[model samples]
Target: MGLRQDLRRGIRLVKDVMRNRKAQGKLAEALAAQPPLEPHHYRVGVYFADGKVNLYQMRQWYKPLAELSKRHPVLVLSRASGAALAMLRESPLPVAYVRRVVDLERVIHEQDLHVVFYVNQNAKNFQMMRYGRRWHVFINHGESDKMYMTTNQFKAYDYALIAGDAARARLEKVLWDYDFDKRAIPIGRPQADHYSGTLPYTPDERTVVLYAPTWEGDRGAAAYGSIASHGVALVTALLATGRHRVVYRPHPRSGVVDHEYGVANRAIIDAIAAVNAADPGARHVYDDGPELGWQLSAADVAIVDISAMVYDRLAAGKPLLITRPANPAAVIDTSGYLGACEWLNAAPDPATGADAGASMLARVSEVAEDPEARARLGYWVERYFGDTTPGATTARFHDAIDHLMAEWERFAALHADDEEVDDHDEEGEADEDELG
Candidate 1:
């Protein structure tokens, strides 16, 4: 029996390798076909080690990196293989894969990298941290009020590119010894400026409601996801109205932590599909695409979980509802928009019992038409994001980059003396050797 199990495992491993061989071949081809990278080719490098599983965390950086490339040569640096490598291939920005520490050092030197940005706090990041000259900036994937946003690990980076004052305040509260004033830079949300994407449905008189729920988090405090408790209830209520256009965009990691939550999410999606099929002209959407701006901008009202999606929609100054986490222990930061934003709480856990959607319909209807809720959005938008004028956020983002570049130059200049001294000592040693 043991021998048979071993044989089966070995066979499965072989089959897996064979299945991935084509993707591996494609990656090799792409790498070989890459144009010769000259010394000082890229100024900025976004280091992401999360791979394909957490690709969503890296996707938000695409548009911002694309725009930054226009001003300074920007490239994505990855050491991920297989699925991660395959996903990197599809990225809009140029990518360089370095597996070994020595290879990473070579790229850093050859590219004359001025700044390195990190999206997540992967332990592998410490490998890149060895390079002391370049500025390591922590530009997290999304902005949210979750405990993950204000982690102690934040102090690891030389600098952190935050969304706005709210982020700065969060860090200030948590990081006791760190210098918040000098290190934390408020660039606002750059992704918002590049909010250009195709909308599947045309503008109409129907109320377009975007229901974007985050995944059921791994821990209890982070378990703020509303898909199981509120998603079906809210979505069904809206669809039943017959005057609403529902757009369901569940987190990619939905059901990953909890299978039951995933089942609930799928049920809501299937319900939306059924609604669309019944009324062909309803144009209900199931957005599983990389594009986020279209949904945030197109929706008349957004029903989102207590996550970054809430803030992103807040930036649009739309009538948005934050689903109160069903978990009583969910941690919520009251320092920012979350404190003032309107909330919709579903009772009796929509996942259990009959006529679940009925109870939440009235609340959804009331919040959807609340003029007061719409009015309060502007004040919070400006407070959280600061100045929603046409290009204000983008300009602030560029300004932050410019400040960092100038600072890097000064830092390099100050450190150049030490480098020169080392060079002189080596030269003197060579002269002594020649004399001997």
Candidate 2:
């Protein structure tokens, strides 16, 4: 069995290498066609080191970054060729493909970037963080109560642009001796202001249910995925009910770690396809698209696992159900939103021989119509992302950037006469290995 697995891994590695080379070539051609970026043009830089698989992290920031560029020009510094290629094609902001450490340094020298934003905790982020004279701020991909939200890595950045009160409170509990006032800035959820994407299906009387589950986690403590547990049953039940429209948007990395989880994800997609084939009017969607806003805004009820989708949907100030993790080892932080949010259990009813789907239908109906649950959702929304009023979050986000830029000018004046120090000596040799 070990030898067979090794062979499969070897084959996958070869395919990945070939694919990456092709992407690199395409990226080079695309870059050649566009005129080079003017020197010292961009003041804000977003550092994304992950490959194409994690582009969702960068995608969510596109609209917000584009809007910010109006005041302070924004540029995306992409480390992976695939991610750079995708950004060049679709991103609203300019993209610089700095696949090598030296290439990244060139951008630093050419551009007067005062604020660099990081979307995830990718290890390669440290490569860029080593540079001084600029602020390295952690503006995470999404807001959630997961352990990732309060990681010690938050200390590594100069500052963190958090969601709101709940985020600040979440950090204060886990991080020790951290200066929240100086380091953490509550900008609310700026992405909420620009929920892009058009509806795929026409609106109807059918109640739309968005089931956006996270990936099967790498470890036991993070095993919060419901695809293998609550997903199939609930999705089946919803599809069977002619009155419900199911929008299945599984995590992009779903089943990357587990075979069973992958199988269940495929099953849900197949179910949606079969249902749509039989009834064209049902419009049961198998959503693997890049856009996220339409599903959140259009859905009457959203069922999500213990991931960022919880807060993403919550920001909509809409009714949603959280799927209870079937894994006993999975850690649950009830200190914040999860503690009070409504939960959907994965257990099957033995007495009635009913699956979780039937129970999910009832829960969905209750959450959709319950005045009390709606009231609770309103409170949590304000707590996590204050002032859902259109443009409120966006204004706050720009204000934060303006504040940082002003601070940069203040410090730049203080160190104006100091000898310029080069920090690239520590970067050593750049890794030649490319991600597919």
Tens-place lDDT digits, model 2, residues 210-268:
99999999999999999999998899999998999999999999987786799999999
Residue 119 CA displacement from its true place in model 1, Å: 1.1
Q: Residue 429: error of model 1 in Å?
A: 32
Q: lDDT of each model, Cα atoms only?
A: 0.79, 0.90
Top model number, lDDT: 2
lDDT of 1 by residue, 1-436 (tens): 6787577668856865665565467667878878867678788888876545577777877887887888878878776555346555567788877655555666776787788999989887887776777799999888888888989998899999888877888778888889888888888788788666888987788988889999999988999899999887778888888888999999988996676898999999899889889998898999988767888888888888888898888888888888888898888887787888777778744554536566566656677788888888878777668877767888887788888889889988888867522111222222110000
lDDT of 1: 0.79
lDDT of 2: 0.90
What RMSD value applies to candidate 1?
7.7
For model 1, what is the error of residue 332's alpha carbon versus the real structure, in angstroms, after optimal superposition?
2.0
